[model samples]
Target: MSRTKLHLLVPLAALGALVFASLSYAQATVGTFYQQETFTGIESEFVCQPSPIGVVTNTVTESGHFVITDQGVHIRGTAIQDYRIDFADGTYLLSVSPSHFERTATSSVEVFTEAQQDRGTLYSADGQVIGIVSVFTLTHITWRDSNGNGVPDPGEFTSEVSQFRVTCP
Candidate 1:
């Protein structure tokens, strides 16, 4: 090979290796995932009374189709709330809100790794806090089976946390 051609080939080979290495090491988690909140008990001033049984609980469910990018994990999705309200009267309301929330994913740490942990804030369609107030940790990349139970539970995945609320209810 000519000297000039050899020099050019060497540089090209090095550049190719660099590109391949970077791509191989890139941390990219792009897929659809759900985020949810389980019935973590209720907080209200007015004690509800039911003739049969009084129950207070809330479930906040949200999901995202996220792409891990250099900027951040960009996600666009919605949240729907299914709740039951027990009135001070014997009347009980089993309601799925007429409204669902749409939100853009916000970030504290955009980078993703296996078992990466993060605590970040989320905003609803109307700019209300919908995620956990204290902290929301992705304990693992996805679902984790704890308590040695083969069946997956509600709080077993990244979707559900303890303190999540759709609004102050």
Candidate 2:
């Protein structure tokens, strides 16, 4: 090859490599590590109580499995939670219950924000979307006193707020 042609080819090859590297960095995969979070919320019969007696505190602390493919990111797992009054009346209300959840989205940041964008959305350091986040309603809830008792009855309240999040480390 001629000297001028050789120089031009070398520059072109280097430019192509740089562009390829940038694109590769921008893309995501299933990931080597799992993104995890702990979900907790309060359920009560009374409107809002600073003290506890009839109020139930629920928590779900479990790791979820996630996969990011060409189509989108998908997450699936069973979250188990325990409830308790932790107050005078709720000592016996703590027990583990499981809820199965799974979601598929175009990006890691889109899953949690799709239905409740105002509540949960994750952003990158440079303002790019990096993950999904926030507290949300996991299921329909009922909180009526079945026996017509003024105080909250056992198992009388079971409404939960859950949060699912994912961010690349």
- For candidate 1, write residues 40-120 as lDDT tens digits: 343353222223243455565655454443333344444444555443443443434212222222222211121111122
Residue pairs with backbone overlap in model 2: 109-131
Measured with C-alpha atoms, the lDDT of residue 70 in candidate 2 is: 53
TM-score of 1: 0.35
Worst 10 residues of 1 by lDDT: 109-118
What TM-score against the true fold does each predicted structure earn?
0.35, 0.36
Over the stretch 78-169, how does candidate 2's per-residue lDDT look in tens digits?
44444443334322233344444454434112232111111223233344543432222343333445566534567765553444432221
What is the alpha-carbon lDDT for the whole of candidate 1? 0.36
Q: lDDT value for candidate 2?
A: 0.37
Q: Model 1 RMSD to the real structure?
A: 19.6
Model 1 misplaced regions, further than 4 Å:
1-28, 35-37, 43-55, 98-169
